[model samples]
Target: MILVDSSVWIDYFKGVHNAQTEHLDALLDNPEEELAVADLVVFEVLRGFSSQRTKREAQTLLLTTQVVEIGGLDNALLATEHYRLLRQKGYTIASPIDVLLASYCITHGHDLLHRDADFDVMETLRGLRTWPH
Candidate 1:
């Protein structure tokens, strides 16, 4: 299973292509792969479609993917811990939502599919694995 980040979904909705986001769509097309989205990702994606029809389409598209919410004592603690560790490693502390999303993906042992470099720090410093191709 893979935890998809908002960036990829946004780019896909906008029909933009990048290395990682393109790979993410391709990965999801594979029958063997399963896709998941965090609450943050869902919120981000919903904003892209203002028309009810498009939004409903978006909702239906998303329903095809599993919803994965991550906000618990363990997730909170890991976010805090990961924040400190990332800070200590000289990386800028990102938004709490990013931390929360990353924490969720990491804790669940799901490979993240994202184009932004923000996650690379987590993948490098934390043991967060991402889609390679």
Candidate 2:
């Protein structure tokens, strides 16, 4: 399973051209690729849209894919551990949500699709798998 992060979803909805967005586009076209969005990602992406119509459009499209629940005490605990581990390795994750997202993917054994540099670091240091290798 590939969990699409808010970073890629935001850029995808805005039609921003980038490597990650392009990769997402390809994944959307492929029937074999299983893509899902975490609930936290949905919150992050939907709250950014100023227009109701645009938000509805994005919501409708996003809802077509499987929605993964990302909130739980277990996930939070794991996120804390991941944060502390990264900090001990001389890295500081900027967003609590990013740590949670990465930890969720790690524990669930799902690959992530993202445009954030922080996720890249998590991939390297914490074994967070990401799409496009």
Candidate 3:
């Protein structure tokens, strides 16, 4: 399964039409591709919608995919460890949330589809798989 990150989802909802969004669109079109959304990603995407209607629509769209629940003690500890490791490697992630997302993806063996640079860093340092692989 591929975890769709909020970065790509945001661009897709806005009809941004970039490579990442295009890739997401293609994935949505293909029945063989399994798509998922981490709970944090769902919150990140839905919370940004300005209107209730839009938020509901966004929720509906996200509901089509599997919702991966993260944030248990084990996952949080793993995320913290990954963050420390990245820091020791002279990398500073802007959001700890990204660490949690990456950790969840790593643990579940799900490839991520993201436009965020933080995920790229995670991919390099932690063996996080990315789509279009």
Candidate 4:
């Protein structure tokens, strides 16, 4: 399964014409490709929409994908470890949320579909996989 990141989702919702959005559109059309989303990603995407109608629409669309539950303690520690390791390697991610998302993908053995550069850094620093293999 591929975890769709908020960065890609945001661009998609805005109807932005980009490679990442196009890839996501293709993935949505392909029945063989399984898409997933984390709670944090959902929140991040939905929270940006000020309109209730848009928020509902986004929620409905996101619900079609598998929602990966981010559990406590163990996952938090793992995220922290990932962040620490990356920082030690002289890599700085803009958000802790990105680390958590990468940790979730790593823990679940799922590929990530992201437009953000931070994921690229994680892919290099760690073994985080990105879609299109």
**lDDT tens digits by residue: candidate 2, 1-133:** 9999899999999999999999989988888988898898899999999999999999998997889887899999999999999999999999888898899999999999998999999999999999978
Better candidate by TM-score, 1 or 2: 2
* Least well predicted 10-residue stretch by lDDT in candidate 3: 65-74
Model 1 per-residue lDDT tens digits across residues 1-133: 7888888888877778788667867776886888888877788788878799988877787778888887777899999999899999899755677788888888877888887678888888988888763
Tell me each candidate's TM-score.
Answer: 0.88, 0.96, 0.96, 0.95
Q: List the residue pairs that clash in candidate 4.
A: none
Top lDDT model: 2
**lDDT of the candidates, in the order given:** 0.81, 0.92, 0.91, 0.90
lDDT of 3 by residue, 36-127 (tens): 99898889999899999989998998999889887788999999999999999999889877899899989989899999898898999999
> Which of the two, 2 or 4, has more lDDT?
2
TM for candidate 4 is 0.95
